[model samples]
Structures are given as C-alpha cells and as structure tokens.
Target chain A: MNPMIAAFLVLAGLTCASALAMAWTKNLLHAALAMFLCMLGLAGLYVMAYADVMAVAHLLIYVGGVLILILFGIMLTQNSRADQYETHNDLWTKQSGRFWALSISLSVFLGILFILNRSMSSFGMVSNEIQRSTKLTHVGLALLTEYSFAFELAGVFLLIALVGATYIAKHHE
Target chain B: MNDIPLSYFLIVSALLFSIGLSIMLLKRNMIFVLMGIELMLNAANLNLIAFSRQDDQIQGLVFSVFVLVIGVCEMSVALAIILQIYRHFKNIDLGAEKSRF
Candidate 1:
C-alpha cells in the first residue's frame, strides 16, 4: 500500500476509535478527552485532503475555542452536593435497550456503504491536477463575490446567536 | 504514493456518522448528545472535502467552511441553552422522570 493510503487508514482508525471510546465511556470527562482525540484525527484527515487552511482553522476553533467552552460547560453544570466536598455528576444512566441503537446505526452505515459502492464507478476519472496553492485567496474572493449575501447573513446570524446565548445563559431573576 | 480513493473517505465518513447517531441515541447527557451532533456534522464535512478534491471549483470546500461556522454557532447556542436548563432543573440529563407528569 502507498504511504498516502496508509496515512489515511491510520487517521481514519484514530477517528473511529476515539468516537467509539466517546460512546463507550460513561464518564463525561473521558468522553470529552476522546472527542479531543477525534478532533485531532479530523484535522489530520483535513491535511490529507489538502485542506491545510481548514485543518488549521479547525484545530484553532475546535481545540482552542470549543474544547475550552465545553470544559467550562462541564465545570459549571456538574452536579455538586452541599454536604460533600467532592463534585462529580452521575453522568451515565441505564438505557432500556442497547441492541436497537446499535443495529439501527449499523444498518445506516451499511446503507451508505452500498450507495457509495454504486456511485464510485460513475465518478469521472481524471489525473489528480496540481491543487491550487492559493486556497485562502480564492476562498476569500468567492465568499465575498459569489456568496456575498450568504457571508453577510452568516455574520448577522452569528451576532444574533451570541446575543441570544448570553441572554439565555445569564442568571434570571 | 497513490492518491486516496473517494470510496475510502466515504466509508470512513459513513462509519463516523453512524457512530455519532448511536452516541446521540444512547447517551443520557445533553452535552454528550451535542458532541454526537458535532461528530455527525464533521462526517458530512468530510464528505464535502472529499468530493471537492475532484472538482475544480472547490465549492465543497467553501461550503464546508460555512458548515464549520454554523457548527460552532450551534455548539455555543446549544451549550448556553443546556446551561440554562441546568440552572432551572439542577440537572442536565435528558429524559429525567422528574419533569414528566
């Protein structure tokens, strides 16, 4: 096998394994850690796909920003008992049935696999062209020119969301 | 090294999506469910990037960037809502029996 394929396999393994760990673990903290690993693997995958800008942005946004936010959320929301100094929420609960969930997900995966297998042969074959090195420039131009309205709308939406989130999270009288 | 096939990416994405779905269903914690939603979104993003590799326009890559922004916005808003829920109920677990009549 070629090195690219090998690297892809490794990254894919890391992503899948960490995701499974996130599902398997009962401790909320462990799941968060597993999500960190999963996000790391996703960044690596982005690099493999030649989306260096995305990889870097993803790392910054997810690792630097969202993970910290999640940690803060965990800290703030954890169930604490007044009588005991220790603080840990009972994060796990017994579900009535695990088999149904697993089976449903497995079938969905298999269905997607089948569709992908059928569509793979139809993709036009072409030599891999040299990827444009000017990704950031091109993306910026496209966002401003072709998708200008969407870009402005996203900014507005983000501003609104931030305001609303802060209002909702504030201590209510 | 040979180029990675589209199928490889698709398969991986499918697996990730399925895992995310199962996690969303099985986990009791609201935060865990949110994380699962993130995973599912990322899986879709992976598919977009994979397809964009074959296209000259790079539309998928651009779309995925927007998707990323939306995902972050969703996360922040959802977590804030969860915090409010915790403040009100003193717990963040979903489907708890106390609220239901």
Candidate 2:
C-alpha cells in the first residue's frame, strides 16, 4: 500500500479505537481524555484531506476551547468528595440486551454503504487537484458575500442562546 | 484499492455516525450523551469536507465551518444547563426516578 493510504488507515484506526474506548469506559474523566485523542485524530484526517484550515480550526475549537469547557463542566458538576471512588454510576445493563444497540448501528451502516455503492457510479472520478494554497481569504469573502445573512443570523442566535443559558443556569432563590 | 477512494471516507464516516448514535442511546450520563452528539456532528462534517474535495465552489467546506461553530455553541449551552441540573438534583444522569415529572 502507498504511504498516504497507510497513514490514512493509521489515523482511522486511532479515531475509531479512541471512540470505542470512550464508549467502553465507565469513568467520565477517562472518556473525556479518549475523546481528546479522537478529536486529534480527526484533525489529522482533515489535514490529510487537504483541509489544513479546517484541521487547524478544529484543533483550536475542540482541543483548545471545547475540551477546556468540558473539563470545567466536569469539575463544577462533580460532587466534592475526595474519597469517593465511585463517582460514576453503575450504568451497565444486562449483556444479552446490549447487543441490540450494536446490531442496529451495524445495520444502519450497511444501509448507508449500499446507498453509497449505488450512487458511486454516477459521480465522475475527478483527480485530487491541489486547490488554492490559502483558504482564509476565500472563506472571509464567502462569509461576507454569499453567506453574510446566515453568518449574522448565527451570531444573533448565539447571543440569544448565551443569554438564555446564563439565565437558566443562575440560582433562582 | 487505489488511492483513498471516496467510498473509504464514506464508510469511515458511516461507522463513526453509527457509533455516535449508539453511544447516544446507550450511555446514561448526560455529558457522555453530549460527547456522542459531538461525534455525530464531526462525522457529518467529515462527509462534507470529503465531498467538497470534488466541488470547485467549496460550499461543503464552508457549510462545515458553520456546523463547527454551531456545535461549539451547543456544547457551551448544554454544559451550562447540565451544571444547573446537577446543582438542583445532585446528579447528571438521565432518567433518574427522583427527577421524573
């Protein structure tokens, strides 16, 4: 196999393994750390796909910002007990019924694969021509010109949601 | 078979999406559920970036950027809400009998 394909497989494996670890672990902190690894792998995959801008943005947003947010959330919400080892609830159900979730997800994946296989014939196979060197200017222009309204709407929505969330979260004594 | 085919990306994305869904359904912790949601969002974003590789307009890439922003916003607000819930109920697990309406 080519080096690029090999790299892709390695990244894919890391992402999937971390995700499964996140699912399997009962410890919340361990799951969060696994998610961090998973996100890092995803950013590497984005870089491989020639979306360096997105990879950088994703790393910044998820690793730098959101992960910190999640950590703080965990800290603030957790019970203040230095001695309690069982912070996480025992949430495992019976083993026999657990397979249903995996089976359902597998069937959904197979369905998607079937659809993609049918549609693959129609899409022309285009070579991966290297695109522009930088996306910052193009993204800025598109945000201002073609997507200005939606951009503004997102800002407004975020503002409203922030205000609402703050209001709801405050102690109402 | 050859270079990384579009199908490879699609299948990986599909698996990610399914895993995310199963996590959402199976996990009892609210924070874990939120992580699942984030995973699902990223899976969709990956699909968009992969497809936008073929299009000259790069619309899918642009859309994915917006999706990223929205996901962050969602995460912040949801975590804040979870904190409040924990303060009131002393727990963050879903379907607790004490918190039932």
Candidate 3:
C-alpha cells in the first residue's frame, strides 16, 4: 500500500505491457515504439532500484544512441517499391509461426517462476538491507580506481565498434 | 519505511526475459531480432542491479556497467551486418527461401 511499491508496480506494468505489445505487433515501427516505452520503463525501474546513475546512462545510451541507430537501419533498409513518393515506409515485418514461439516462451516463463519460488526460501538468509544512498560517487570511484582497466578497455571496444560499423556500412563497389 | 522486496525485481526481470525470448523467436526482421536481444540484455542488467542493492561489494553494479557497454557494441555491429545482408539479398527476412545462407 506504500508509494514505493505502487510506483514499482506501475513501472513494471508499463514495461511488461509494452514488451508484450512489441511481441504481438507485426509492424516494425510499432515494435520500435513499444521498445522505446519499454526502455523508458526500465530506466524508471532502475531509478526505483536506487541506481540513478545507471538509469540516466541507460536513458542516454538506449533511447538517445541505440534507438536512433535502429531508426536509421529501418530507413536505409526499407522495402522501396515503384511508389517512390510513398510517405510511409514498409514497416510491416513477417513473423514466424506463433504456436512454437508462444508455447516455448510460456514454458520457459513457468519454469523460471517455479525455480524462483523454490529458491525464495534460501534468499531469506541474505541481508535485507537496501542501500538507499546515491551510487554515483561510489560507481565513479570504482570505475576509475578498481575498474579502470576495464573502463579503458570498454572505451577502446566502443571505438572499435563504431569504426567497424561505419566501415561495414560503407558502399563497396 | 519498508522497501520493495528483491523478489519483485526478480519476477519482473524474468518476465522481461521471457518476452524477449518470444520476440526473438517470433520476429523475422533482423532489426526486430536485435531489439529482442537488447531486451534480454537489459533484463539481465536489471537482475544485476537488483542483486547489487543487497551486496556489500557492489560487484553486480560494476559488472552491469560492462554489460551495458558490450550490449551497445553488439547492437552496432549487428545492425551493420544486417545492413550488409539487406544490401546483398535486397531483404532482411531470415529463413527466406530466395536467399541462400
């Protein structure tokens, strides 16, 4: 009945519903929209979990960078027909048979729920203290001091990925 | 003054993971599949964040940051490859009989 649980439930609902929408829709653009909402809800959930830094980073990277890239991919790869002046791109995507997908995912979901239910008793022994403090300072210090090597490595990896993507996407005659 | 239980976060992550799996299995477009992969990655990241809340070392938080970086890298590379595939076959649909993979 508290506000925190209420917010969590609302955010989780938004996330799961949009994810289902993404799964149910055949239109690629609609799926993208659903993904956008899903990412938003996830960021909110991160904030609720007390990782505000991660929430912001997730917003910037996924919503700002990745979603734009996805849109560009959709634009460049559109199924252009003779109607060159058509405003709407062919956003509809073909789907595989639903029977197998639904059944498999359903079973997987049920299995995970069963496992979690069984494991819940063991988790009771774990510390219940929730760190409500801001993690920005700690995360920054850790990234620079303890995790410096990995941080630099990630920077290099990102640079390589960017360069490689552009190279592969370039027109080769 | 009570906080949300860890189990709630775990349940949400599980749901998200399964939805992502179904999306990966159901969608035919390369980009759609990529989106599904992103969802799955985020679900794992959520689990890490939730666990980090309870851990003294905060290892899960640090690890999740790396996971985020790796995910972005994967997305960029995959989209590039998808673009190349589209160029080669004039379509990005997987398992299409017209294109020999």
| lDDT for residue A100 in candidate 3, whole number 0-100 | 100
DockQ, all candidates in order: 0.67, 0.52, 0.85
Query: lDDT of model 2 at residue A104?
Result: 81
Model 1 alpha-carbon drift over 4 Å, by segment: A87-96, A125-134
TM-score of chain A of each: 0.88, 0.82, 0.96
Give a tens-digit lDDT track for model 3, residues B31-72: 999999999999999999998898767788999999999999
- A best-first ranking of the candidates according to their lDDT comes to 3, 1, 2
- The local distance difference test score of each candidate is 0.85, 0.82, 0.92
Q: Write the per-residue lDDT of candidate 2 for residues B1-101, one digit (tens) a residue.
A: 34466777887888889888778777777888899999999999999888776666778889998899899889989998898888888877777665551
Cα lDDT of model 3 by residue, A1-173, tens digit: 89999999999999999999999999989888999999999999999999999999999999999999999999898988898898874478999999999899999999999999999998878866778999899999999999999999999999999999999988888
Q: Which consecutive 10 residues in model 2 chain B have the weakest lDDT in total?
A: B92-101
TM-score of each: 0.93, 0.88, 0.97
For model 2 chain A, where is the 10-residue window of minimal lDDT?
A89-98
Best by DockQ: 3
Residue-by-residue lDDT tens digits, candidate 1, A1-173: 78888999999999999999998888888888999999999999988887887889899999998888898998898777675665554455434258887899989999998887887767656425737464778778888999899889888888888898898888999
**Residue lDDT tens for model 1, B1-101:** 45787778888899999999999888777888899999999999998887787667778888998898899899999999999888888878778874331
